[model samples]
Target: MGNICPETYPDPFNFNPDRFIKDGKINPEVTNPEAVFGFGRRICPGEYIAVDTLYVLISSVLAVFDVSVPKDANGNPDIKPSFSIGLICHPDPPKCSITPRSDRHKELVQNLLNSDPTNE
Candidate 1:
């Protein structure tokens, strides 16, 4: 109930990261979206680590790839965000294209993959 509260977050249904930003910086007054990690005494202890790891992972991926919704035959972006209903909401396999942003990024990805010790 707290997660989707329109009073705390304007246009709650919309994916807007800008809501937390003000004057080109994170707004201190804006409430942190920490409800997913639980609340009160039962709040998740690993939430900080989890959020940090996610930030690193997402930044790394964005540095190498240009991720976008897959285009249809008519060249229209096919974007329909759907999720499975359950205890843990899981998003459906996205219909998207994750391609290297440039030749340099492609080489960087290839190099990293090739250097993986587990691949041997």
Candidate 2:
């Protein structure tokens, strides 16, 4: 996956989802979906469900939250991309600000959290 990542992605370490876009659509050439889910017999059985779950989670977050790099003591944005390498590569949580996009979004999220039994 690491090998193909650099080859397909311009900046493999950066969060550049636009790389997957081609003519306003998802470009299969650069989009390496197989990397997350194994190939052939080793492929994850729940790959479809997993992908759906991720799509929903990411989309929902983006709908309400304005996630951005956190500022350092000097008030300069600090962004150093780091990842954990293994059978499956995943990024470590970076210093960032996760605030609601608007007052309405904040209220919605707050209400959801307040109503959610699991949040307790």
Candidate 3:
């Protein structure tokens, strides 16, 4: 982004998933103390599970679906990728569209969502 919040990341542009992977090994940094789940010593005991779940979910999504933007006539994302600053940070939301890779995939997604009773 034009304005990089170095605090969110001292080197905001850098890929710092060091703890997630390093030397082709899962680094120990994040497993020690992280607030992504709860906080302090009394933090969620299942934090590791949460982390693993996130890894699986994200990996599965990217493996099957394409994540890109809604293209304009020129075949470019309608919006640019920029830095976002707030409680949670991300690349600025892009103008995008999502579609299953195939009818089978669509059905799988629909079935999963429809089967979820908690969804409204």
Candidate 4:
């Protein structure tokens, strides 16, 4: 928890959503709240929006398929990643795999695609 060395952190390392969740719960005690939100009042004014969006995103994902980290050459997911900083900090991409949980989901995706209202 001391000062981190940039040389040690990897760029575009493995992704671990559970890193944001701990003890089967979501709270500051679980992760660095400041890092998730920001430091002090200088934090993003859109914190509320961001939190709500995250809730919806996680809920939606959990309601559907299971998620996991991408295995490395040895078939393990032990990659720790770094982040980018600017006006805002963005997380590095993690290697992972995604697959539909059921045929219902597949059909739903197909239906949405088939009924695309954006079609000409």
lDDT of each: 0.85, 0.82, 0.67, 0.63
Residue-by-residue lDDT tens digits, candidate 1, 22-120? 999999888887788988998999999999999999999999999997777999775666789987777788777789999999999989989999987
TM-score of 3: 0.45
| Deviation of model 1 at 25, angstroms | 2.3
- State the local distance difference test value for candidate 1: 0.85
Q: Write the per-residue lDDT of candidate 4 for residues 1-120, one digit (tens) a residue.
A: 211332332221444445556577874543343455556768778888888999999888766666777676998775677689777667778666666678998687678778998863
TM-score (all chains, Cα) for each model: 0.76, 0.73, 0.45, 0.57
CA lDDT, candidate 2, residue 48:
89
Clashing pairs in 1: none
Worst 10-residue stretch by lDDT in candidate 2?
1-10
Error at 26, model 4, angstroms: 5.0
Clashes of 1: 0
Tens-digit lDDT string for candidate 2 (7-116):
76676677666888899998877766565666787878998898899999999999999998878799877777788989867788788778999999999999999999
Task: Please provide, for model 3 over 37-84, each residue's C-alpha lDDT reduced to its tens digit, 9 standing for 90 to 100.
Answer: 566778799978988999999889976676776677998556546778
Query: Global CA lDDT of candidate 2, please?
Result: 0.82
User: Order of all candidates by lDDT, from best down to worst?
Assistant: 1, 2, 3, 4
RMSD of 3: 6.5
Supply candidate 4's per-residue lDDT for 35.
Answer: 57
Model 2 / residue 74 / CA error / Å: 12
lDDT of 4: 0.63
- For all candidates, the clash counts are 0, 0, 0, 1
lDDT value, residue 104 of candidate 2: 99
